[model samples]
Target: MDDLFRGKHHVKVDGKGRVSVPPGFRRALEAADPNCGPERNATVYIAHWDGEPFLTCMTVRGMQEMTEQVRAMHPGDPDREALEEFLYENVEELRLDDTHRITMPKHLRDAAGLEGEMIFGGRGDRFRIYSPDVPKPAVSRLAQQMSTRPAGTSPFALLPDRPRPPAPGPRPGE
Candidate 1:
């Protein structure tokens, strides 16, 4: 399976508005952006949803893909401008320092209501940092569903496993 951002981590927000990125997440970011190394800082784009108490973060490559999608829209389309404004105006580029942490800007911290502690949940190519008060029933529900799937029907069944043949059954005249 491809390397994916997947996990839930709790991190403390310091008085200075800095939060350390989980180590595993740092590795994932490095994997997503191969150009990043010890000397080169990895870039992350953060966007806070209006009226929502969370901030979505993605690698520079992911943000570039989103920008390309918006650029594909017709120039005269009104929605295109709105999307461009919403994305370009609200997004902030954060560079992970040597300590693997970034200072959250005041606007983003206020939008997400971040304070003492926050939850960082990975979602495929992106991740979200949410206040501790945010409800997480959806994640639990997904876990339940995955656990209940019948054998051999898991989405990950294509991964390498012990080879098996079809069960034999009576055929022809019996």
Candidate 2:
């Protein structure tokens, strides 16, 4: 299985609102966008939903997938409109610079209460940026719950199985 983004990084936000993306996370972003290169910087969509204490950053691919899922809903559905307003209307597409840094928009920074220090945490196809002052009790709870899982049992074992390739036979010479 493809290993999506995974890690936690602490970065400093300069007075200009610029923050450097962690090297590993930068690589993950690049990998998520095949078209990204030295000449073309990868773009991330930031969304600060109502009542959320952090900003969610998603790769272009993730954003496209979310958009597609949203489009699949009925055009006149209230839920669809609310989702669009919350996700699409509130999102800001920011392009990484050559130094793998981006200037967090004023609105987002203010909404997330980001100051000198911020936390960037990877979450598979997306990531979240939180203020240093955010609480860690939820993280602790999740770790506690995960530790209770029975040994040799995968958390995903209950999920439907995906198709796998057939085993290859030995060569004729062998």
Candidate 3:
């Protein structure tokens, strides 16, 4: 399997709004950015959509892939327009520094109501930066769901254990 982003990290947001990314997450981000190496900083795209309570972080390559998908949708489609706005206007590109930290812009911090300690939840291909308070109604729903998951049930049990098939080849034109 690929180097998936997993686990949760509680990170401190500094006075200047910089947050050091967890080492594991940094590795995945670097690997996903094709041009990143010792000489180049890894790039990240953070989406601060008002519909969500957290900032969604994506690797440079991952954002590119998502952009392509959005571009393929019909121009007049409302869903496409919404997705495009979310992908473009609401997204901020931040490059990781030598210490693998990115400075969260003031606007983004204000949008997510982030300060002090932030929660970094790895979500496979991407990760999320959430305020400690997690004020969204979705968080309440998630907590309720967790409360109802039968006692002694393992979360991993929900995932299929079978090995994944290899990824498909590139499109014919490309």
Top candidate (TM-score):
3
Candidate 2, residue 80: lDDT:
94
State each model's CA lDDT, in order.
0.81, 0.82, 0.85
Cα lDDT of model 2 overall? Answer: 0.82
lDDT per residue (tens digit) for residues 80-127 in model 2: 999899786899989899888999988889998999999998788888
Residue clash pairs of candidate 1? none
The true-versus-predicted C-alpha distance at residue 74 of model 3, in Å, is 1.8
How many residue pairs clash (N, CA or C atoms closer than 3 angstroms) in each of the candidate models, in the order given? 0, 0, 0
TM-score preference between candidates 1 and 2, better one = 2
lDDT of 3 at 10: 92
